[model samples]
Target chain A: MAQIIQIDRPVETSKSKNVIRKTMSICPECMKILPADVFERDGKVFMSKVCPTHGEVEELYFGSYEMYTKFSTYWTDGKGALSPNVPIDKCACPTNCGLCSNHLSHTGLGNMIITNRCDLTCWYCFFYVKKGLEGAYVYEPTMEQMTAMIRTLRAQRPVPGNSMQITGGEPTLREDLVDIVKMIKREGINHVQLNTNGINIALNTDLALKLREAGVSNLYLSFDGVTPKTNPKNHWEAPYTIENCRKAHLGVVLVPTVIKSINDHELGDILRFAQTNIDTVRAISYQPVSLTGRMSKKEREKYRITIPDCIERIEEQTNGEVTKDDWFPVPTCSPVTHFIEAFTKKPQYELSIHFACGAGTYVFEDADTKKLVPITKFVDIRGLLEFLEEKTEELESGANRYVIAARFLSKINGFVNKEKQPKGLSLAKLLTSALLKHDYSSVGQFHLNSMFLGMMHFQDKYNQDEERLQRCDIHYVTPDMRIIPFCSFNVIPEWYRDRIQQKYGMPIEEWEKKTGEKLEQRLYRGTLRRNIAKHEMNQMACATQAAHIEPITGT
Target chain B: MKYVYEPVKGLERTCIRNISISSSSDTVRLDEPVDFTVKLSVAGGIRDAFTSDLWEKAWDAWDKTFRMTYNIGIKKVVAGPITKDVIKSQKFVRRATFYWSRSPELNPDYSKKIWVMVVLEGREPVHPKSVDEAKTTLFDVKKTFRVMGSDLGKGKHALKAFGKASWGRHIFGEKGNSQSVSKEITITCK
Candidate 1:
């Protein structure tokens, strides 16, 4: 028999209401339960306890108190749903758009949309750029906006000063590109640059001259193949021919999006074009499409190619003079492929190449010099967007004239001597000398680990072939700009990128304050000591083992 | 070997002091210290040649001691100039054999034999505060015996003889354990 007690109920009269809110704290490391009211300050949660081994576990915070328990369990098992209660309100499109802070941290490269319109729509475009996908007016910018963006860029300086690359369906399609360049120069962002298809420069020599006059230093030109026949359409979307590129008088790096069936056999022709356009054309970068975008999985598979195969083809065509082993991985994009110059016969030395999947970073060894070098640069597609938004004020200036002039002259020079141009030092060779000189033994190996960590960010599996990507520290970079305690091998889904950008939407100012490490300084300051310490600790831990001894007398 | 003794009530103090040895004491031999003395003597002239090994034994023992203290290992000690300082008198003396008196006797078959009696004596007493300059002295009785009608040089052989003696803790002078019984006798042809 159960005893039920019923107290006197209020006679349906409502006067006041009393509400009780319960809170609890959690341990991030072990997920042990703790009461909430222990320590609370500035809307942050904390708890302290002495573990059995006398390990003093310190404070921890729960961004959303209601979902703390759920998060604890989720992190432990890598399962469970996100904290829906603590909804992200900053960014407009959270889950839908992939520019969240978390995603940005994982994707070290910044995004720069040169224009809304594109001349050719590749089926495997990663940006979801389709026929009707264009946003806003193509090439729409006021001098004020450009200037303002430039100013913001200067103010929100990132660590390890990165390059700002303007890219679109074709940045040249935008008439104001020259003006934009001028504004970038006027704002004194000497590193301002663009990624483009050289078509406009080839058709309009005057436009090229103007762009060169604006003082644009380098050009990441989309020159996918040597011949139009390499494409299925037998088509070349870029308006400029190899001749026009020479005339541009700019340091043009030939960016080729290698398609497996179409241009896989044209390695020789591509290298030949590069050599012919020597001084004006710096390096030929072969990029195999990641097959992300509006294309179907089947279609992507049909067209997707790899960088290794290209390296092999180059070796075979050049009779081993240019081989795959000679190529060195780019610090930022090591997993995708390597970069090689015309001169290196399996070069064994270099400056330094780094991979930055946010702060999860690594550098690489030089194939020519076999030296360990620091990672000097990285790519941040989202940061580029932030740059465009911030530096809108300096979009127009007289300095733009020099950029256009340089391009025009370089292109004209090439056009005149298209057949028998004298070969010169390649940009890859120069950059190798400048950025990658191995300063210490075993540094190359550490850099390789850092690179591997970064590659792990993009894909779940380790790409051993990517020398740098296989060796980088993967978990160092965090969404709030704080580096992880060490590189943790926790898997981060690509979808998280969209969520982070949408939720935190951390501005550059906030990033600097939170990280306590100036972003721009990372470019010059090497983190070799930290890297070496980590390696030493890893080695010691690996070698330590238990031992037993017994007395010979058996006493 | 054990000896049996029975006593009556009045003879209680007269008990047997049995002395059992694994072998005869006089039969024992020492390999070193050839110039040494023993309580036993040769039974005949021919016997003296067989057991007269004292000079060799003494020389060997002296050499061993000298080697242990010097002339070996990393640090070698070479004998310096033979100065009088090295002839210091021994603070105490020990002997393996007791002092003995010997008398020669003629025998048949052209052989000779000797009768000997062992004796021991204490050294002369001296004042406590005498200026004792350390010096050694040897008995000069060499002229008492002759072999093949030729005189042996002054007691050199006797002086060279050293007894197979054991080191002692006390009685640091010439007055201890000087008398004992002789096991045999010796004779030299003249």
Candidate 2:
């Protein structure tokens, strides 16, 4: 028998001038879809929903109403997946989501969990040893299951997901991690990112090199803050981990799970640190922590930090180097896909996601002053982009390629002003060549001078919007050959993550008895003595180089 | 038609008059048609002083064909690569040239000299030395150009256009005079 749930909401009052928009939300307790009102009060946007059994619930939907409106313009509908795992008539919207035909976006970044077993027990983590112990299941997928998951992701239509992230309680716990990476690469996945706490990489340098050699593109390292107090999980070992990544030539993107009044204050410090070690640190993705576990309304308010709050804090802390105005929602690039499709007359890859899901921008280091420069400083990006959109229309209207190319050349100068561009940057030439000639060598040159700065705020049950779920492009592929959106999988674990894992997982005692080895939680306390000694020796070498090198007086 | 010298008060000064510009729409999609119409009146005809005397004696030197240079400026209201310093210090504009011929018989060589001039905004315009160089300066000859949309960013944008004319010397009319009136429109991209 199908379980039924009832949804209810309070009547709107005449004084509700704060309501910005209306959407659908799910009950945190009953998971019943309900009509929700999005309102603005105290400069923050909140979504209020009512479930008959669960009562009323209100959660912070957005930190700023202005930012929300600004981001809302970039919304676009996505082309549904080609090979949907679930039939449209099978069940409800989210419940039947094996990426059903109703989903709005293609999988941009697919996540595959290798194991549910984690080394440490972080109080804030969604998945921990306690849940596994209580659930009486070891939710680690076998090698076959992992491969099937990857295959399912690749089978997505229009364009296969070229990028994938291997995540877990700790993916590094798997002994065959290098082999797994190799298999993923062999399967033609262009980029394979590993999400880790950075303990194993710091302890074993060889392991880092092995993973890199096996085709691991980069490391999404957990780095909440610079100090041990805010980031107690792997504070002592982070530096060593970063040093190893640098040596192994594996780029690291610091993933900070920001909680309000906790590690939020250290955002600017983290950005500065990333800049200081710009050689190996490619980017910093500040994930405002999602509340999925049990918590009170007061607790939620105390800890919830939205994307706008993070942007504001960064601007304040960075002294306006990275301002609130510099950030843009992730789906702003939808027009690019639109233009490409019209120009090429073929189906193309698109980022047709909800406007409020994420925001990002690029910052380049000015060679002359060594100061951070936002990309907008030198290019008339808006004009060039508008011109491109116009040109794409001309192409679709039967305008010849020569005519289109000619138009591009003519308007290129208007979009990129050479004189006001960076001292060494030739934006006009780069843009012309890139747009007309299709030469991307200049794009590589641009990356050499710039770094990506972005943030993604994943939805939890309290603030989950049905619209966001329908447009979500980031997904996790379960062993059941199902591709579920990240929010649907983790936000309501019982419906997806836990349900699938429980069916495949074994009890910890049973596993221990079968393997004849007792399982224990091993917390990484820092680097080993040898690794620390090696680090000191390298530091001494650099110091010696600076000290021994003198003026040519002796010569 | 041959060049006819119109004796007027601003005849010697050479002035451009009644400049007007308009776009097909105030807002358009990224890959949609956007037509622009530029209408202007030219008076006080003059010729380039650098022409050889022999050619000047044989042809009507005073026959003026307005050489209008279109300047397009774009300001992003959303986050983009353009910085505040770039916006403040530089005129975020690009240039393309168009010529409205008054009398073809008066200057038979006008077709050869009607090539478009592409100028990088905020920089001194460098004269093209060859046809290839001139071709490189131009993407299209028409006033309308299409917008190339991408996934970089999107928001409200102010697209503006102004023009300058060339007679004997580059002529930019006074505030309310013959200068080409600048046109502006707000475009939104999604």
Candidate 3:
């Protein structure tokens, strides 16, 4: 329960599950709280929960028990928010959503839905606005309301949130998007990333430059695959968006919503595509599709891919260039927070999310081999982590700060083999400032030259684990001034997202009448995709010189 | 002809490598200053014999070490307006050396039992993902040395009295991992 996340259920047969920890989960059908068991079978980890009505349900919690245990080694808790909106002591997790005291991590990134409107409607996305649906209301917050939400984020205790992700059906759909970016920056939010389908940016080439000038850090552009078959949603226009962003000097993070038997096969291709455009592309955050709504067990199995499953395919597809051994879970970063907190004597930003939530590693382009070398290969990350932990302990035990600094300078090189690290990396130089000076400029510098591959499988109804909920670092800020974790905010939208948005939103007709504009006016015509087709580079992959693959997998 | 090492009685736990106390000179004059030296050597120190790589034992092994720490010291006196003698070693060590001078106030009979001891402390690290760095002794060791004075006896007797104790010898502490090893050295106070 203390970062171990004892997923419990009544053990059945001795051979079935080697039960490890016991925790609580919710029934997929009725949302009834039930006992769950987390166990290991054949090197894979699984969670089985029992509901009186739904009987016993089993699901794969993690694909690799080896990886699970490895990631759990760095399970360090975070300092909970000093000010809780709901300050109840005894814990009841997802039910207690709005900044509850039981919440483990402070907000790492606050997502604000600038508008629910988008240029294209993809079937997989559930958070966007659908025209024909009942209660199809537009939930675009006014500038004032957004300011208030940013205030809520900045108001977080210990370490106030400094980063914001403006997401929506497509944040670019809002005409005031540039102003919104400016407002977010003005509100003391240092980092602003606009989450969009990139259709608007592709159509309006100058928009990227404008947004960059407005202080937006980058575009969290949705580009699922290298081929149109795997990524039809803006596959045609995405290239133009990246080109424009490059010209504007704005960085981009390619986001692929990977679905098994669908886009999963194209993960390595997506990575290669990112590498091909490594100059402009910052990172690729591959999210395994979280299947929501009612679906048969057979159907769910087709699309379900755990973090390990994705990593396995990545290794196979990359021909073992990137392996499973390279990945470390989200909470593995907690030691840096502990070290920085100890070194700087201040509450620093920590990604103390649940170990099962996400896993990632940095990949550097080796100058000699020209192949992607995972940070783990060149750096002794585990040894460095243990050393940091020991140093933190020494500092806490009244060791002189200068002496610790001197010891840090003397011993840091022992862990990092200079010959193995990528040429021109200056790894120690970049790390020293980030840790010693507490300056994150070095981290940003490292990001510019490297590609960070991350996997964040957001929870849905079928695989909802409350333990993941308690440690959720990615959060959403409501106009009501409550900061809610991402899982509870989107997974159970009826309780949080819908409830809050509906209260603040207006019906489509009413909104149109007030704005003196038709709702369909915001819908972007496929002009960019059609125009890109007529160009000579139409046959090639977006942002690359390689040829594009035709649609084979069904849309 | 053969040296056999029996680990912590029945358990195959890590104990001591070969550690002993030695004086600068076996025989020394009363007015001459003397120094003490502690020599230690071991195979694998206190470490996690259990594989830390195994998921089953990883969590417990993170901070846990089957390994122990040792405090090696030569009990001595600090000369001052109010002179005081140390009863216990203040710090831990594997091999240590100290320089001592005759105190101005203390009479020639100032010496009692000039000895060195090893005080072991703490346990070792992870079940299997990690293991201890291989060394001779996991814990710091203690040893006591004897220099025969004019009142009692004299001359180069600095021989390890512990029978058949040499390289490949193992020492186990029955109490708190603390052991007292005494070495007798020949010194003259003529």
Candidate 3 per-residue lDDT, tens place, A1-555, comes to 112222223434344677655455677777765556678889998877777666767777888887876765555456667778778755655676879876767899999998887767688888777668898788999999999999999989878999899999788878898898888888899999989888788778799999999999999999888777888787777777888888899999999998989988878888877776788889889898888887777887888889999999999988899999999988778777777887877778889787788989899877667689999887888778767866775675457889999999998888777888887787887888889987788888899889999999898876777667777889999998899999988887777888877889988888889999877777767676555545444544453432332221111
**Interface RMSD for each predicted structure:** 59.5, 26.2, 25.6
Model 3 lDDT per residue over B1-190, tens place: 1222223333233444555656666556655655555654333322333222221121211211122334444433222222223322333322110101111111122221111111122112121111232222333234444333432224432233221111111122121232433344333434
Error of 1 at A7 (Å): 46
DockQ for all models: 0.00, 0.01, 0.02
Error of 1 at A240 (Å): 4.8
Ranking by TM-score: 3, 2, 1
Error of 3 at B90 (Å): 22
Question: Worst 10-residue stretch by lDDT in candidate 1 chain A?
Answer: A546-555
**Which ranges of candidate 1 are over 4 A from the true structure?**
A1-111, A126-143, A157-162, A232-241, A293-301, A332-555, B1-190
How much does each candidate deviate from the true structure in C-alpha RMSD? 40.2, 19.1, 15.4
Ranked by DockQ, top first: 3, 2, 1
Q: Give the whole-model CA lDDT for all candidates, comma-separated.
A: 0.30, 0.65, 0.68
TM-score of 3: 0.74
Minimal lDDT window, size 10, model 3 chain A: A546-555
lDDT of 2 by residue, B84-184 (tens): 21111111323332211111222233221222233443322423434445433422222433344332135555544444443212222111223433444
Off by over 4 Å in 3: A1-15, A533-540, A543-555, B1-190
lDDT of 3 at A165: 97
- What is the per-candidate TM-score for chain B? 0.15, 0.36, 0.36
The residue-level lDDT of candidate 2 at B180 comes to 39
